[model samples]
Target: MFATPAYAQAAGAAAPTGGMSFLIQMVPLIAIFVIFYFLLIRPQQQRMKKHRAMIDAARKGDQVVTGGGLVGKVTKVDDAFVEVEIAANVRVKVVKATLSDITPAGGARPAND
Candidate 1:
């Protein structure tokens, strides 16, 4: 008496098969990846490229800020290292890639003067 009727079993059938279903299921995932690539990955890559160009273009007499927060003038540059003069007769060798930003040719003027 508890068994399902034959007509009820025949009424419930499997869905129609189509090749488009797989592609339809994948659309959301593909969209998410594309969004992430443009919104996050692409911009970060561009910033890194610009930063690398800036680091490569550094030269003598350029004032730069280091990752360690020391602001100094670049006295020497090598393939992988830079000599920065933080103060009179005080110099430190830092990795070229560790330089954070290169200040403009003319530094900020003192407010007092």
Candidate 2:
């Protein structure tokens, strides 16, 4: 005669009610999303806004560096494109968004110096 004990303790416990349980389980996930928005998304959006402002302020005669690493003087600016003169009589058309940085009013020093 094998007298095995029946594990009936858990069977008598009632199931958790669904009303507040669902909301309670989701609290951590919602908190994580809020944290990510503040730490990651908000900063990225701010950077984008700053970059857009810089791009919008670009003008002819400004020295700018392209995303491709070319430094040139802005010769022309259109709605979506810019013309840059990398060397005397050597110019190229590039997208406005492709510009990464614009030098301040003072000209940049030559790399050799």
lDDT of 2 by residue, 1-113 (tens): 89997875657667688779889999999999999999999999998888887888888899999999999999999999999999999999999998999864566633421
TM, every model: 0.80, 0.82
Clashing pairs in 1: none
- Candidate 1 regions exceeding 4 Å error are 1-11, 107-113
lDDT of 1 by residue, 1-24 (tens): 899756544566777669788888
**lDDT, each prediction:** 0.88, 0.88
Q: How many backbone clashes does candidate 2 have?
A: 0
Candidate 2 has a TM-score of 0.82
